[model samples]
Target: MSRLLALALASTLGPALSFAALSFAAPLHAQGAAAAALPKPEYLTVEQLRAKYRDPASRFMTIKGVEVHYKDEGPRGAPVLLMVHGSVSTLRTWDATTARLKTRYRIIRFDIPGYGLSGRISDEVAANVQPLDITEGLVDALGVKKLTFVGVSSGGTMGMYLAAHRPELVERLILSNTPSDPVKYDHLVMPQSFIDATARTKANNGFQDMDFWNNYLSYFAGDPKRISAKTRAEYYDFNRRVPEKYPIALVARIGDGKQATIEMAKVKAPTLLLWGNADPLLPEAAANAITRYLGSATISRVLMNDVGHYPPLEVGDRIAQLIAAYVEAGTPKL
Candidate 1:
């Protein structure tokens, strides 16, 4: 059999076995050896990433001493939607949703400093400037008076922070697959099974391999077959380019997150828990827990079946429709 077929078969055998361990034809074994000899993935400089990925809508500005990459699109005078992407994701995560909603609302999305084309967030920058400060500064720099905040995964945590601390700036909120109380539900969110798989896969395959990302994305997806090649390639490329410090920084930042129940009580905006029921990271119980803390806000919950952690990627059009309706009606009907 061909090397491609052999590799494809190996992917089904679970994380315990490495590619080199697969017993294939002599020719395929030699090919696998050749593949293993390739150099490891290298980090891309901000300038290089920008030149390679930036589009006409791309805009750059310094927020709290960190140079930020963002896009402000759609009608200038329209109701604004401020979007924040989750870890391991860039602003482009909203591409499909933005395409559908931008015609009606002004959509603003930014790379959350440590990821994407945003400037490298060194230890010095992270120490001196908080994530919330960067977000607040970005909106202030853009001259936005009020916005509907939309966040996915950890980005949703940031949204809750803003809604609690900077309530005046947030008109509405939509959080997808977000952890309400990590301190309380850490086990449910990051199960040992997932932790073990992650450690094992990274140790064996490393970040440079396409199969690594394929497995990573697949594990997060409700339906692995639904993931597109284009999506896989984008994820693989971005992961390979991100700074070495990102993983640790993200973990530390999440660990430092505020007490959710205390913070969510301060939010006054109409909030929607738009989540995927099949999400392994934040289960339905976690999504329901958010409602308990959001006592002060008008809350709505919609859990879509067969969708995963990343709703924008898994079901963008549906997300866009819900967001548009929620923003217009001032309450979610979903």
Candidate 2:
């Protein structure tokens, strides 16, 4: 009788212990799954971006269907200098140079759609509104009958597009650090490996890939240190606030690079090509390619020593002087 009773008790206790073990392990398993599901830092909002940089001012306007943000300064009657910022960058990128040119030209700088303070396009509106359309809309909204366009990187592409599509509006064109024919320029092509790496980094970090900004700044400025801590903080803040739709829109436009290049041949404005000898992204060869396509357009190349892609910011005074001289020389016949 004692053996049988002991056996029964042992069997019941064993099952109970097994159940308890499983119950205890359930929470740990769930915790692990939760951790795996956590979003990366790259997805974090611009508000969460560090405060090591800052910009001077902000302004907004209704262009087409979106609320466009811009910085307008200097005398209204003065020659217009429309400064276009690059990809993933806001109007603030032009802060250093615009300030120096403000006394001479009416500087107009704006945040392109999906960048800076500008909001995303509504789904109700057609999904086909590209950067070129938005730029044209902005010009129309500003009532700029004629002006000089100074574009950098993506902005340079937009400027070229504008000159091609709307010849009557542009007086002088400045293309800096932007490819004229992005599709034909194999060297300027962004590698799939780079894009994949960036996507992975953003997914894992919950924020944009730091390398993108780092590479951009390094390629732009001869001295990365020239980009002030305050300015960086501001840029990070603005970047963080950027809407998710911004990246989506930008990717869509990039995919349309072929169409953009076709439009480049139609541009008839007198163009000045500015490039930094040390620029890694868009090399001097790319600048020469751009100049080749501009028929009847006067191309003035200014290769700043030690300066990277962003000569305007690294050497604002010099950039302003060159621009002033070009604009004063008279408008190019379209």
Candidate 3:
């Protein structure tokens, strides 16, 4: 893959690519030694996934016609924090951050439809919403009158739309490794090596080929060796659990996202924007676009050194602290 394509994919598709994993089948076979060492993707039953990925607090409920898999944790009546992960990421990606802040805040995270334990989008009334509308439906169903959002990448794009439209429900916002606008295929050009996992995903009915899963995930982490065994297991496990049709469906919407034209000016909630200095995906132009639209006092920008796309994975503790401070500073003291 060219450097530009990789950066664009890493920036725009950060978490979402988990929805889009290994279809690649034969490219690495030529490197016999390397190919022999890669782990094969394991296909798991829904039952198997429930056992492996389940947290005691995790629950399932039907909302708007779709089975929503979510976890609502921490003290009741405390400030609510809704975590929206980017593509390819499930609620589990926030496990580290949840643990860090659960004592002081209630955290809610769920799998977006087409990913994780979430099923297809409903065609019925209220159940048919995608992205922001889907987020509002889920939040309204949860009866959270007031809440904050921590959205990553595509999740960030979703939150931007939600906050812009539903400023009343969203109290504050934190967008990490995020995009102000939905990225298109033109920005996220994919070469063959990038989709080598496509065959793996299709062949296994949407479960990634283990070798392909590892490679695809390694891109987000920026180094394969740095990813932990537990993290690797979690990614592979969840990818296998997602229904094949959703990811396949995304193949058609490659250039699209929920964010059409970002009206950051329409957003009223206080927002924090974060990015890695090393992040290749978001060029200064794209990042500045949002900044230009929002009022200065309503938004704050922070850049991390030596980090890549996934900050919660790379510096969960720092992010947890930053969020805690941001929320505390903005919220009234009880």
Winning model by TM-score = 1
Ranking of models by TM-score: 1, 3, 2
- Candidate 3 least-lDDT 10 residues: 248-257
- Cα TM-score of candidate 3: 0.77
- lDDT on C-alpha atoms for all candidate structures: 0.71, 0.60, 0.63
| TM-scores for every predicted model | 0.80, 0.73, 0.77
lDDT of 1 at 288: 75
lDDT for each residue of candidate 3 in 1-334, tens digit (9 for 90 to 100)? 4443343344324337322332323333423433443445556765677776677787887765667788899998899999987756777778788999999998989887666766654345233445555577778888899988998766776676677788788888788766555443344433355455443343343345555556656655534465677877777677666354444331112234333344466777888876655454554455576666555327777777555567777677778988998898744332
TM-score winner between 1 and 2, please give it: 1
lDDT rank order: 1, 3, 2
| Native-to-model Cα distance after best TM-score fit, residue 243 in candidate 1, in Å | 2.5
How would you encode candidate 2's per-residue C-alpha lDDT over 48-143 as one tens digit per residue?
332322245555676557667677788878888899877456777777788788988888987766556666566633365566666777667777
TM-score of 1: 0.80
Residue 261 shift from truth in candidate 1, angstroms: 3.0
Q: Candidate 1 residues 22-102, lDDT tens each?
A: 322223343354455454656566677788889999999987677889999999899999998875778988999999998
